[model samples]
Target: MELQFFLPMIPPTCTHQEKQVSVVTGKPVFYDPPQIKAARSKLTAMLAKHRPERPIKGKGVRLIVKWLFPKGRHQDGEYRITKPDTDNLQKLLKDCMTEVGFWKDDAQVCSEISEKFWAAIPGIWIRVEEI
Candidate 1:
């Protein structure tokens, strides 16, 4: 079976490359940034409402994520085609997917394809399938 969905919101600026933290009791504390946390919450809520009856389970799965960003200086219909970096953006989304139980584990998603673009309409589009 294949799973597909769209997260229709202005994609947050959060990237997994962002570090979360502070310190207490001689130990380093970690947490999501306020913005990142909010974004995760939004993604989680959306996923929970639509997630499969059971998580996708298998030895190999494929994941594709296409992120559409609000047009910058780019002309209409043109891709963002630059940095913020697609890899960085995928990290946060993948982690959120794991947290929302889209699958047994993100690691189970053996193949991944990610991308970003500039568009008049902005949101995230995701697809998953067993391989």
Candidate 2:
């Protein structure tokens, strides 16, 4: 199975690694910051519309994601080489995808390719397939 689509919106830069930790009862407790929660909500809502009729199951699945940010000082199609590393970005995105029933679990994603770019048209391009 293969799924490909583009979500037209400003890609959020918040990452899963942004989780905040606090010492509660002398133990570490982790929580998402407001921005992280907001980012997850936004991505979940956007991804919900694209969920497959049935969630993809089993192993050997591949996920490809392209995050296109607005071209401010950068030229169109230029690679974004700044903060919000791709692994961090994909971690949040895969979590959202798992929540929205895109697959049984993000662990099913055996292969992943993620990129960020400056583009005149800002959005997210995603492709999920069996490999």
Candidate 3:
């Protein structure tokens, strides 16, 4: 099946219920599954290749630390990727989706990407403002 993709700039935000207050008070939230999956898959592949031998127990992919760590406390603060990282992932997703003839409107692509990302990265949060 074909999957569509989009590259929308999302603001840095928290996913915890306490932080969700901003998302709740601000704009409507939307998520995309396909694009997210593609992007996440691409990221996973990259991480695996570059960070092979990293421990993966309960805390997702561990690179620097020794032994497995339970996903650390959110109080440690939310994780945010750089713009280049986001752009690289988006390009990879778009290329994959385009091959499957899934490229569509911007909103649809963003939703797919968000959904996939959320599923792949547990505890990670993403908040986007509606256009």
- Which candidate wins on TM-score? 2
TM per candidate comes to 0.89, 0.96, 0.25
Clashing pairs in 2: none
Candidate 2 total steric clashes: 0
lDDT of 3 by residue, 28-112 (tens): 6554355455444554443333221322222211111111112234322233332224444344433433343222332333332
Question: Against the hidden true structure, what lDDT does model 1 obtain?
Answer: 0.80
Order of the predicted models by lDDT, top scorer first: 2, 1, 3
lDDT of 2 by residue, 52-90 (tens): 998887657899999999999999999999988999999
Writing each residue's lDDT as its tens digit, candidate 1 over 40-118 gives 7888877676677788876678999888888867865676666778888877787888887788888888899987777
Per-model C-alpha RMSD: 1.6, 0.9, 16.7
Q: Please estimate how well model 3 matches the true structure, expressed as its whole-model Cα lDDT.
A: 0.30
TM for candidate 3 is 0.25
Q: Is candidate 1 or candidate 3 better by TM-score?
A: 1
Q: Which stretches of candidate 3 lie above 4 Å from their native place?
A: 1-79, 82-84, 104-131
CA shift of 35, model 3, Å: 19
Clashes of each: 1, 0, 12
